[model samples]
Target: MGKKRVIQQTEEELIQETTEIEQKLQGDVKVAKSGLREGRIYIKSTYNNTIMTLTDDKGNTIAWVSAGKIGFKGTKKGTPFAASKVAEALSAAIEKVKVSKVMIYVQGVGTGRDTALRTLAAKNIDIIGIKDITPIRHGGCRPPKVRRV
Candidate 1:
C-alpha cells in the first residue's frame, strides 16, 4: 500500500505566495502616478532583463520594474523587444505621474539603450536631456600583461 503525504504551508509562506501573485497581476495593468520629479532606467548585460526605475532627485524610487516582473523573458535581453518592453513598463508606472520635463541618464552600451529612448519619445515624454553615463577610460587597461618573450 502506498502512504499518503500531506503538505502543510505556514502563514508566512502563504502570504509571500499571495504577494507574488498580486504583483504579477498588477504588472499587466497600467499604473499611474502624479507629480514626479525625475525618472531613470538602468540596463546591463549582466542582468537577464532590463530594469526600469523611476525616481526623483531625492533618490526616491517612485516605481520599479524587473525583467521578469513585467512578463519579459527569453531572448528579450538586450534587444529592441526588451527596450520596447521596458518602455511599456515605464509608461504604466508614470501613467498618472505628472512629468513636465525629464533628464535621462543611460548607462552601459546595450542594444536596448537606444530603443528604450525612442519608446519614451514615442510616448510623448518630454526629454529635457539625454546623457550616457557609461564610464570612459582615457587609456587602455593596465598595459597589456607584459608580453612574455
Candidate 2:
C-alpha cells in the first residue's frame, strides 16, 4: 500500500477560513435602522444577503430587512422573487414604523435590483434617487485570446 497522504492547511488558508467565519457571523443577523431616518430608503445587495435600509434626508436608517432573517436562502438568492419578498417585508415594516417619502439608493447588479425598485415604486414609496453603485471598469484584461479563423 502506498503511504497515506496527510493534508495540511497553510497559514493563509487558516486566516481565510477565520475571516470567512467572522464575516458570516457579522452578516447572518439582520440590522434594521442602524442609522434610520424618516424619509429615505437604501438597498444594498451583497453576496450572502439583500439589505434594505430606510432612512431620511439626514442619512438616518429608519428601518431595514435582511434576506436571511426572513427565511430566504439557496436559489432564492437575489432573484426577482426575492426582491418581491423583500419589498413585501419592507412594506410591512414601513406600515409598522410609519415611514413616508423615501428616496432609494440601490447598490448592486443582481436580478433583484430593478425588481425591488419597481416594487417600491408600485407601492408609491416616492423614490427621489436611484443610483447604481456597482463598479464598472472598461477595457479588456490582458491581450484577447486568438480567435479561430
> TM-score: which candidate is best?
1
Which parts of model 2 have CA positions greater than 4 angstroms off?
1-38, 46-48, 137-149
Model 2 TM-score?
Answer: 0.60
For 81-117, candidate 2 gives per-residue lDDT tens digits of 6666677677666655656656677887667777778
- Candidate 2 shows a clash count of 11
Count clashes in each candidate, considering only residues at least 3 apart in sequence or on different chains.
3, 11
Q: Which pairs clash in the backbone of model 1?
A: 32-96, 33-96, 33-97
Residue-wise C-alpha lDDT for candidate 1, range 60-121, written one tens digit per residue:
66676655665544765556666666677777666657666667777776667777778788
